[model samples]
Target: MRLFAVLLLALLPSLGQAAFRCGTGLVDEGDWPVEVEERCGEPDYVAVYPEASLPGIGIVQTVEHWYYNPGPSSFIRRLVFRNGRLQSEDSLGYGFLPGAAGDCNPRVLNEGMSEFEVVRRCGEPLSKRVTWVASDAYSRYSERRSGLQGVYPVEEWMYEFGSNQFRRIVTFRDGRITDVESAGKPQ
Candidate 1:
């Protein structure tokens, strides 16, 4: 009984990460976006970008990032999609509960995190970009009142943690994290 109990405890983290799986193998890179959603259900967070016209392909591609918070013991999984297909996958390190204790770890910062929460966890960013959106250009959802429109605040905060490590850029709209994208390897 004790041996069985020990084995169960050891299996917990893998089990949590495997909570969502596809037939035969776990959902992985190259899996279609639809297959991922169907097997894993909805992700914890989603960041959609404006459509971009591919230079010569004449194809308009939609890119997106989906984040999943498995559990405390498991790392958050980030899935990148391009043109409705999974393009890449990354383990962004350990996950944590919302409003948890102070942590400078970037993995704790996630989409929908408020500006205050970000500062509280990771302190001020290396740089910041603020823009006043006069129209609904970046709005993901339509405004309820068509006539009531005015400039809204949008910001992008970049955190540089030095060379070869993952860097993060957090986007905020109305002071809340609308998207969190991983930048290229720190240089």
Candidate 2:
């Protein structure tokens, strides 16, 4: 019985794929946006990516990430939707109280952090710029046969700490931070 229970516990993650509770309700992959909204209520933040076009599929899917911060006692949840269906879910570090400013320490910022994580820790930026870059998909049979996978959005967010501090610019690609740089104070 003990071995059986342990095996079951080990397999549970594979069995469930991924899911999270919303009050008394549960949201899982493949759930519709409306159902998630109904179960989880409004999200704290939402990021929408431009439509991705496959080689033969035309413009078949649009991607969005909805972030929910259920206060300081719980972990933040990020629900990813593609074409109106929940494709996956992620749990961020921790939730923060609504309307409270996040820690804006520039030293704490680093690469590979998700957009939600940045927002959770640093709050909103002073200004933002967005652009789309083309990503390539290679053929399985031949590496030479490359095609346009899709255009992914890249965003640069600027944060100003104080007059004595240099402004920091954080760049994100595919929802993850790729670079952080400093610029002179605004004139």
Candidate 3:
């Protein structure tokens, strides 16, 4: 009986994939994002990541995470969107009520930090872009003359906290934060 209980516990996570229900509406994995939104109404939070690759072809798949908190009795449901379609759903176990957390501060941002840490500290960016940066930007001028000729991809994230707050641009190279720049003035 103990072994059977353990097996059932292990299977609990898998059971969550069995379609998402909101009120009287039902949403499945392959449903479009519009359908879920219509059923669940506007979500509490919406985060979008710029681009991702899909199978076969190189597509600009806009990946997004939609967070919904139905009520105090329901868990937080995170619906993943890939290319404007529902990809998956995850149960966050508990929901966060309004005003539960403080806003992220861009002033504390520093170099040599991980991407995840940046997001955790500064929240999601208003915009993001990946570009090819020349090696000379970070390499020594002497090395450039010595024939180190190549470019690497770098990711830039922009944050705008409104007119009262300063905007910031965070740059990442090879998945690690390399620079942070101020783009907005304090009011």
Instruction: Kindly give the number of clashing pairs for every candidate.
Output: 0, 0, 0
User: Over the stretch 1-187, how does candidate 3's per-residue lDDT look in tens digits?
Assistant: 9999999999977766767677688888878878887888887777665443323454334557777765457676777776677877776544445544534677667787545445545677889987744445553442343243344345899987678777888987534578989886645
Q: Candidate 1: lDDT of 113? A: 69
lDDT (Cα, tens digit) per residue for candidate 1, span 4-123? 999999998777553345334467556788788877778776766533332345324455778776767987766777667776666665776755676676677777665555764787
State model 2's lDDT: 0.77
Q: Cα deviation of 177 in candidate 2 (Å)? A: 1.7
Candidate that scores best on lDDT: 2
TM-score of each: 0.42, 0.76, 0.47
The lDDT values for all models are 0.65, 0.77, 0.66
- Report the error of model 3 at residue 97, Å: 2.2
Question: What is the Cα-based lDDT of residue 142 in candidate 2?
Answer: 16
Q: Write the per-residue lDDT of candidate 2 for residues 1-187, one digit (tens) a residue.
A: 9999999999988766777678789888999999999998988889986545555556545678998888889888888887789988877776878878767688978998778878777888999987655533312221232233554456899988788889999998657788999988976
Pairs with backbone N, CA or C atoms under 3 Å apart (clashes), candidate 2: none
- Compared with the true structure, model 2 gives a TM-score of 0.76
Off by over 4 Å in 2: 1-7, 51-61, 135-148
Clashing pairs in 3: none
Output the lDDT of residue 16, model 3. Answer: 62
